[model samples]
Target: MTTSFAQVMIFLGLGIGIIILLTAVFRVHAFFALLIACFVVGLGVQMPVAAIINVTKQGFGHIMQSLGFIIVLGTTLGVVLEHTGSTKVMATYILKRIGEKHAPLAMSITGFIVGLPIFCDSGYIVLSGLNKSLCRRTGISVVIMSVSLATGLYSVHCLIPPHPGAASAATTIGVDFGRLILVGMAVAVPATLVGYGWARYAGRKFNNEEPGQAPVVDLSLPTPSVLLSFLPVIVPILLIGIKSFIGIDANKPVPDWAGLFMVVGDPVIALAIGIIMALLAVRSWKKSTVSNLLQEAVEKAGGILVIIGAGGAFGAILAATQVGQHVSKVVNLQALGIFFPFLLTAVLKTAQGSSTVAIITAASIVQPLLPALGLDSEMGKLLAVLSMGGGSMMLSHANDAYFWVIARFSGLDMRPMLQVYTVASLFMGLITLLMVFILSLFLL
Candidate 1:
């Protein structure tokens, strides 16, 4: 049965509305809400009952299979760094060199680099304490540092590879992964700078001081060296970037030496290696302290893993409906040019509050229309991935986990969160879209 465009819109709207209602209004957990949304969309699209079940299972399993271990390893690495004071060491080193006046920029750069390997939530958690310390020491507004870091983390999280969102989008759209990396980096730097600019402006305008006393970091503890502190975050990015350069493909023969980099460069393995390095870097701590930290890391990772799985399931169900194919047939998306992908992804991200889901679903929708949209070329495909990524950054509000991570960790009230972090994301996303549009003009 052919689903009409209007019908598809209804199904899509119902699905997204239910998710927003459940998560934002009724206060349901995102995991349950996303699962419910999958069923709603499936049923609304009139998918068979049996098919819905299978699709849900396949979607959940596929996402978990691809990303579960990577997420866990990344979280473990984050936990190890957070507990071991490595995050603080790195923050302090950067601040000391740059001076306190540029604390926001320093934190932003730190977030940009660290977020390459770590999830934004985990990165924020790992650095929030250090953010507070920097704020206290420098009298810089915590709000400024918080938004700057959030923006930095988010810029790469949405744009760059080794981040599951961008990588997954690249794979889904059949773009060359290595090229996506280069394009994403080019886009991310400008997006991050836009974020930095907003954070600086917002920091001055909204002066809501942190309410409570800052947590005292122990100065006497034997912290890891700055170089050691960096290895967990840096090594994986370098290896992965190198692997992208090597260009592995099933059709071509790869060198034996390249094999080692491939093994180490896989996001899961690279982060796992990071975890091992993180553990070693903190080896001097008491055994019980280490044990507690590991346990805590596991506990924190549980919620995020569930949300990711649910998001995957939701995306799967959307794919099953073939809404993108239908939309491609109905809309003259080519007329809109580069803005088409960006607008579509922005709507998806704003509705669902998961950038990874937004990227995956948008890429799927855009893939079928690539030729029609003049995005069938190599460079065009990269731009499409980036345009979608830029859109994914729009309006990260109550529903986004990263939003809460920024709000809770940085101790901002709801009003401030909306004003600072949420608005900044919207601005940053627009800036990124502008950059993508300009790039498309040249590349296309």
Candidate 2:
């Protein structure tokens, strides 16, 4: 059954709006809100109501099948890295290079680079914690440092594809991975700079009242090998991009290594590789038993896994309900294609406080409309991904996890945290939008 623009809009708004409203009001998990929205919209639209209901199960199951293991693995590695002080070492290396004179810029770059492969929440768990320690030493407020780190992470996580969120968006819209990376970089650099400017200016205004005090990283911590440290993250990225750009086909057998790449490129597989490799890298088994590090990894991954799974459920329902399609049509009728992706996703992010759901919902809705509008799927997908990133960065207030983390770390009051973290996110996101808009004109 074909979904027309107006009908799509009515259902889409009703469905997505209800989810957003419920998320805000009831504080129900996004996953539940999305599922409810799906049921409501599907029934209202009279879309194979029974079948659509069944499809919801498949949709959520598909996400779990694809991503369950990966989130766990990522969580484990993140926890171990934090406990091991690898984060501190990396920060130490970066801070030394940038020096106190431009540590903020350095943090921004480091955060951006690290965030490309890692999720923003994970990055914050590591970077924000480290940044706060640095703040105490340098007399810099935790607020300034946290914003710098968050800004950096936000740019890469949002703009770059293949970090689960963008990868999901890309698949939904049939976008080429290479195009996302190429075009993403074009937008990312400017976003980084703008975020940097905001962080630095705000940092200076706060005047490091908290004092600079990067806790001396205890080097005795059990660190992993450099190769193992970077392998899983680097390897999968290479595979997806090369395969996408080169157009490897059925006629030619995939090289053995390429097949391995494909296996590892699976989000679940890639992160699992990292988890297993981390065990070896720490030399836990070779030295003796592997209890401490292994257990730590599992523990760390628990919260992240629940949240990710819930996010997946939410996204699945959004697609199943077809509200996204409806909303995109309303957008099309207004000739608002370029901004529709951004505006729609931003509303979700602002109202619901879950960027993952915002990106996923927008991409799913926008996906069904690409051909009808004669639009490039890549354009719509990439825009939707970045738009969610932008909106998520728009306000780092109490609703945001980063808000409390930054406030607690820096020992700053709510008012000042807003000045540094909240405003910096807005500035950087705006710059990112500008870059995306300009590039979309040429690349799309």
lDDT per residue as tens, model 2, 1-444: 665656655776788788778866778776677777777666665668666667676766765565556555655655555555455456667788789666677677778766765667666666655676566567664556667777787777766654555655665566666567666766777877887777767666676466333334343447665555555445555555665544435477777766656655555565565555555555534332346656765675554444444445545555655554565445453366556666666666666766666676766666655544445555655665565556545555666655665565456777777777777767766776676567567756
Per-candidate total of colliding backbone pairs: 0, 16
Residue 51 in model 1: lDDT: 87
Per-residue accuracy of model 1 over 377-408 as CA lDDT, tens digit each: 87788888889999999979987878877877
Q: What is the C-alpha RMSD of each candidate to the true structure, in Å?
A: 3.3, 4.1
Q: 126 in model 2: Cα distance from truth in Å?
A: 3.1
**Cand. 1 TM to true fold:** 0.85
Badly placed stretches (over 4 Å) of model 1 are 161-183, 206-221, 248-252, 285-291, 351-382, 398-419, 442-444
Error of 1 at 42 (Å): 2.5
The top-ranked prediction according to TM-score is 1
Each model's C-alpha lDDT? Answer: 0.78, 0.62
| TM-score of every candidate relative to the true structure | 0.85, 0.81
Q: What lDDT does candidate 2 reach at residue 395?
A: 53
lDDT of 1 at 145: 83
